[model samples]
Target: MDLGFGREKRLLTPQQFKAVFDSATHKVSSKHVLLLARDNQLEHPRLGLVIGKKSVKLAVERNRIKRQIRESFRHNQSILTGVDCVIVARRGIADLSNIELRQQFDKMWKRLARQRLAADQANSTGQTNA
Candidate 1:
């Protein structure tokens, strides 16, 4: 499994981030973060993080949050195949410990996966019935 989060696994451009922001197909949120996901055409999933300074004042905190988010995404990337995911940090996120953030991401990833699977099944059945 290619678990490395290389450049190809990142949403690198403005357009790529905008695409997910404009028409996110799946959403999973918690008190400290919100994740928006849209299906993409690639064979792998891509990730974008929006940990603004307004949300987390210190640059060090922001970087820490980004690291945690990326690590979580790397472990759970398989569940997010062919999707573009943007995770926006909310206020108070900087207060959470690494373990707490990890747990939150794990739960959110599972929820998003269940949602996507349900939607895919619904779409497939709808097309067959049409």
Candidate 2:
């Protein structure tokens, strides 16, 4: 599978980000990060980053955090299909080192993948029972 971080794998427009924000059906969070996700009706998952200055304070720090998030997503995209996710950065995230950031995102991605699997199973079973 092509696990590249291309434009098609990113939530480029405000409208796409807004859709995930407004109707996020799954949420995974930590002290300094929150991940919100919903079904996108697509073949691959798209990622949106919301690392505001208020959270990270400096542009460099925010960019670093975004890079870590995107890298983690790229490595885990195979298991994250058919979802649109928005990762919101909170205060204190900038304090984490690169290794910590990577670990945190890896944990969050696993949780989100599990949620997606459960949702898919539920949908399939619900359809059959209907």
Sequence-dependent TM-score of model 2: 0.95
- In model 2, the worst 10-residue window by lDDT is 53-62
Give the 10-residue window scoring lowest on summed lDDT in candidate 1. 101-110
lDDT string, candidate 2, 1-130, tens digits: 9979989999999999999999999999999999999988899999999999888888989889999999999999988989999999999999999999999999999999998889889999999999
In Å, residue 59's CA in model 2 sits off its true spot by: 1.0
What are the RMSDs of all candidates, in order?
0.6, 1.1
RMSD of 1: 0.6
- Per-model TM-score versus the true fold: 0.98, 0.95
